[model samples]
Target: MITDIRLRSQQLVNPAFNDPKELVAWMGALQGQEYSMAKWAVGLRLKKPDIRKVEAALEKGEILRTHVLRPTWHLVVAEDIRWMLKLSVRRVKLAYDSYWKNHGISEELHIKSLDVIVRALEGNRYLTRQEIGEELSRAGVIVGDDLVGYFLGRAEVDSIICNGVDKGNKRTYALLDERVPPMKELHKEEALAKLAIKYFRSHSPASLQDFIWWSGLSITEAKQAVGLIDAELIKERIGETDWLIHHSCARNVRAKRVIHLLPSYDEYLISYKDRSMALAPEYYRKAFNTFGIFYPVILHNGKIVGNWNKSAKQKQFGVESSFFIPGIEVDEGELDKAKERFRVFNKGGND
Candidate 1:
């Protein structure tokens, strides 16, 4: 229980640091599969909650969202994107090989598609996914319905492109080099050590297995990486489980009495291989569905005690929640405070 408290505190929700780019860099990569919610994930860590601040950072090219770990979209800073892609994209590419092969996407076609995309997105231009697909079609490259997303994902995995600003409701793509300033690449071992340090420091009280699961690195490779950073880390035994945390992380912590409305797919829940510490095992099915859809959760003092959802009606915000902690009296004031945080976040602070 003390371990869980310290781990949540390490998430830096108070945002003693404010820059979204710095926050993203510190965490290595934030799970960004759900674009809008991902923005809120970044927002939740800020001293003043505002989702638009994250969006503004995206527009200014301070950060780049691309396919990094696990072949899913992640919000990563410009400086770290290259080395991070170099470290993890190979495993992702190998995993996606069968999907690409099934769609008749050949090496020649992939190269041709990249060339077309590069030419189309040159000169600081940002093209929508549909626009990029249209450009490929005009070039005699067949990007079928299913092939469109796979092809674009390949461009990101290959580090040729990344998500840019939004075009109305649609997302646009930009040449990564044009958006992000040039950064020196790191050697493989150095890169591994850096990544290990970042992950543990930002998401501490984690295990080697958790790092492997989050990074898509093999157990051997993960072990080697963590070994490189051993001097900077502290190991602890919580029950029978051995956890690795940064030496600087909080110890001698007590369970927090605060409540947090954590977004779906937030790194706190998704970054670990085992969630039994933050989420009770029996209630996992209640918070998440069998199809892997994680609803927004009401986190009370580091434990996921319930799931919550919100809606907007005529500019009025409403938050609905269900707590799993039995016989606990409902504190409307506390619930309202949690709701206000989300209210400000969702409204982008206009409220």
Candidate 2:
């Protein structure tokens, strides 16, 4: 079970990267539904984790956030964006079909919007969502509040626009081609194989169902992709359930009684259809809710024993937790270390 924890969360051998881009590249994509938490998700995997540095990487175009895989924001490396889109764009488009229909986002509108957005963001300029909406309206496309977001989200999924540097505190969009250098696109088979391998390597001891849920690939496609990477993956039968893990993952490491302040929508929790391995069924409601909200979790030795929240203002950080597994003794020192980690992340420094 402990081996399950280390490998599934990419902690095998405990390697740490200095660059957020490298981490995103290796992990394939980090869920970006909660943007700030997504930054910390990548930060926690790096040696010197800091929110500001991850934001710097985003500004430098080392990594890009866009609507990719599963019709949500995912932080993907610039070099892989083209091939990733080639792999998942059709699926994402299909997922949004109903919204497109209800909002009258016809093919013509998509095409026209693309042209308008391209012209508006030409010369490597960035534009906020509101600015883009106004530009669309000026072009005779009345994008109401709801449609405005749908338009931008559709545009992003279509690979026309991507995250630009933050203008003040508001996020801006840039032409994907301008922000990301072109990379040779991979053939569908090769792309599927590569994505499967990356996912298995980073988030293994997971089932094909988990891959389907995380990648938004159909079960048939998931099986095909997994088949392509069979040589690199090892299968284990834990109880009645079968799991796939990377061949190189260490299986001998003992799970220490450690604590981790996993951020909201952490990949450790979100990258699977089944979370029973990491979360106890009895405490599920406290950490996860019906509204698709995943709160910050308190992980004690790879299992979610509770949920935690932090309040940070200026340089001060305060953390509070509610434990589900009552009477479980967590050393006070361990709690302090967890609080300090959150402090460093919140303060954006060791201080």
Model 2 over residues 1-351: C-alpha lDDT tens digits? Answer: 633455435642254578788889989998888888788788777776677778889999999989888888898998888888877888888877765776656888878887898999999999999999999999999878777777788778888889998999898999988888778878888989989988988887788888999888878888999999889988888887788887866664565567778888888888888888888777888777988888998777777888788665546558888788979888779888877866787578557
Tens-digit per-residue lDDT, 1-351, candidate 1: 444534454463345557787778788889887888788788877777787778889998887889997878788888889899989888888877776677666888878888999999999888898898899899999767567777788888888888887898899998888888789989989999988988888888888999998888888889999999999988888787788888867666664466778788888888887988778788888667788787788777677788787764666678888888787565678778988988888787887
The predictions' CA RMSDs to the true structure, in order, are 1.8, 1.9
Model 2 scores worst on lDDT over the 10 consecutive residues at 4-13
Q: Give me the candidate number with maximum lDDT.
A: 2
After superposition, candidate 1 runs with Cα above 4 Å error: 1-9, 12-14, 312-315
Off by over 4 Å in 2: 2-9, 312-315
Question: Model-by-model lDDT, in order?
Answer: 0.81, 0.81
